[model samples]
Target chain A: MIVAEQKPIDEIKKMVAPYQKLLILGCGTCVKTCFAGGEDEVAVLASALRLSFKKDGKKIEIEEKTIERQCENEFIQEAASCVARNQAVLSLGCGAGVQDIARQFAKVPVLPGLNTTFIGVQERPGLFTEECVGCGNCELALYGGICPITRCSKKLLNGPCGGSQNGICEVDPSVECAWQLIIDRLKTLGQLDNIRAYIPPKDWRSSNSGGPRKLVREDHII
Target chain B: MKTSPSNLQKTLENGKFAVTAECGPPRGANVKVVRQKAELLKGVVDAVNVTDNQTAIVRMSSIAASAHLVQMGLEPVMQMVVRDRNRIALQSDILGAWSLGIKNILCLSGDHQTFGSQPDAMNVFDIDSMNLLRMVKNMRDNGKDMSGFELNEAPQMFIGAAANPFADPFEYRVIRLAKKIEAGADFIQTQCIYNMKRFKEWIRLSREEGLTEKVYILAGVTPLKSAGMAKFMNNRVAGMDVPEDVIKRMEGVPKEKAVAEGLKICLETIAELREIKGISGVHIMAIEWEEKVAEIVKAAGLQK
Candidate 1:
């Protein structure tokens, strides 16, 4: 799922400063699971902002709302009334969700409250690490399910760039060397020869290099 | 079949022990220092390597510096790394370097950006060193650009890549070198050698695989300035191996004569490397001590 983290409270406060009435809009799907822009997060931010404004002797009206999902038009329509009453919205959603809400509600100024990080998997209960870069071309089969493009700091297709030490990357000791992981996994799978096969330079057009990508299923289209 | 001949290429092809040196362009547009460094190595060395934003520190472009070296009648081995430019910039620069009469290029995946002054800067490793070598080779062999467009005139360049014998998973280093050679690397310049025992092991592995016969391998050697510098490189520099004995040799010396002792160590290493069967030559990297390069090269009997 997409993972994101909330911006600093000071930055969020500044973004909401000009508006007399603000809506803290949250998404209930991916962002919710990541704890960035969820219903509970929205309430906490709303209460914090109310107290901050109160101490400053400002009478700013704060409203909170959480939609099932911010990316879908059907779910976005559910927040129309709350959005109509607010002067601006502090979108507690991923970048896609914020952009979607802004696209639907053209008049209201939508400010992003969360910094959308990456497409990641939860490594532990509270730790999420990026697992995919959505390069549009998947080559996980070659690397024993390890995504070198995303996990490797250098994005080296033919790597472990002389800095892999005891499975730790030279860039950071905390980060595991992606190539080391791939070699280890491959050894376990009896495909160690895969490392010997020279993977040529990747054709990057499938990724973001070609610009914004979209998909259409003609058969399923209404 | 060679369209153009580079002195270093000719030297290696002739089976002579080649000698190359590095010249760092000034952080600002001070071409005087660049010229001085090149001048110091003028006839003593076969070619001078102009580093490209080495250590991610913003410096004058290696291309421009190499151009200046060309004007000085010196062979400039322009070093291009993947840290700064995407494929477009890289290909464009290769053509530009060729137009300026630069015949050699060393492809490397440069140091990470965090070590530089601009730590927050975004790095664009659009291609790694291996791919860069292949792309350059493609341009030369196919007479076409990376985009598959035909070129009216393609650059004939002597390609080079980097290797580190001291880095971890030590057995795999030779395989990586083989991969780079297969990817069209014409020459290989290793990282600075301090742990000769470990480096010998790597060289032996390369010999067993017959990699040395395929590509010219120039061992990288840096004359240490002081014991402090030796410790810093061992502890702080990634993938560098500075054995305790080498550090002790420097630390054992008095502070006043440490630099001279350092040069002696480099000379001994060169003498030893020449005796190795697969070793082709030496690339002396006297960082910040470019003035000492001529003395070391002459002492090593490379000044012909």
Candidate 2:
């Protein structure tokens, strides 16, 4: 899922300070799952902003609303009346969500309230770890499901790179060496020979290196 | 010798044990530092390796420093790391270095930026060390760029790569060495050796796999300045293993006598390295202590 963290309250306040009437929007998909932006978070932020503004002797009205997913127009249409009534939207969603909202309501200013970190998984109860880079070319099968491109510090194909010691990465002691994980997994799967074969230079054209990528589903288009 | 005009290549091809020392470029644009180090290493070693932004700290460009070495009548093994530049810059520097009369090149996946002065800098590991080796070899042998465009004139370089015998997944080290040889490394210079047992085991495996016959193996040796340095490397430095016994040996000496003790240990390691069958030569990395390299070479009886 796309992981995100909410912007500091002070920064969010500064961003919405110019508006007399503001709508605090929340995303109920990836950001909601990560607890960064959701219905509960929006209500808390709205109350905090109201109190913060009142203490400053300012007259500002704030409204709270959350959609199923801000990226889609169907959910965005549900909030049309609320958005039209407000002067600006403090979107507590991922970067994509803020942009999608901006595109849908062209005249309204949609400000991002959360920072989109990475496409990752919730490793534990609250800990999130990056698992994929969306490089467009998936070679996970060869590496026993561990993505070296995303995990390894050097992104080395033929690696470990003289930096792996005792299953730890030289880059940081806390991070597990990706090559160690690859080697151990391959060994368990009886596919240790997979790593022995030299992987040629990666064709990065499929990655972001080629530029901003666009995917079109011709078969699904109606 | 046919592959490159590198003096180191010629010496290795002639079946003579070669000697190479590392010369780290200064943090600032100081030509005098490079020249002073060059003078100390002039007749003591076959070729001097000019490090490229070693430890990820910004330094004088390795290509520029190597060109300076060429002007001083010293052969330089220009070190290029994958952490700084992409293919275009790497290829361009290769051509530029060769044009300046530099012959040898060492391909390395440099030290991570977090270890250097600039921890906030973004790295450009567009290609790994293996890719760099293959690319250099291709440009030299096939006379074509990575994109298959025929170059007007390709750089003929003696390609070298680094190895860490002490690193983990110990059984896989030899396999990686063989892969490096296949990827087009003419020579392999290992990380500093303190754990001789591990180094010997790695070499034995390499010998069994016939990797020794395919590429020249230069065992790396660095003289420990003090017991504190030994302890620091053992605990802090990643991928480097300094055994407790070695640390004890250094600590056993007085503080004032530690330098001499360090040199003695280094000389002893070189003597032991000479006895190893598959070992081709020694790469003395007297980091910031380049003057000791001359004394080491002379004391090891490797001085020409």
Each candidate: chain B TM-score: 0.98, 0.98
Query: Given the true complex, what DockQ would model 1 score?
Result: 0.63
User: Which residue pairs show backbone clashes in model 1?
Assistant: none
Put down candidate 2 lDDT per residue, B182-256, tens digits, no spaces: 889999999999999999999998988988999999999999999999999889887889999999999999999
Q: Ten residues in a row with the worst lDDT in model 2 chain B?
A: B1-10
> Tens-digit lDDT track for model 2 on A1-222?
899998999999899999999999999999999999999989988999999999998889999999989999999999999999999999988988999999999999999999999999999999999898888899999999999989999898887889899899999888999999999999999998888888888888888889999899999899
The candidate that wins on TM-score is 2
**Over 4 Å off in model 2, which ranges?**
B1-4
Q: Quote each prediction's TM-score.
A: 0.96, 0.98
Instruction: Identify the CAPRI category of the predicted complex in candidate 2.
Output: high
Model 2, residue A203: distance off in Å is: 1.7
The worst-scoring run of ten residues by lDDT in candidate 1 chain B lies at B1-10
Look at candidate 2 and tell me the lDDT of residue A141.
Answer: 92
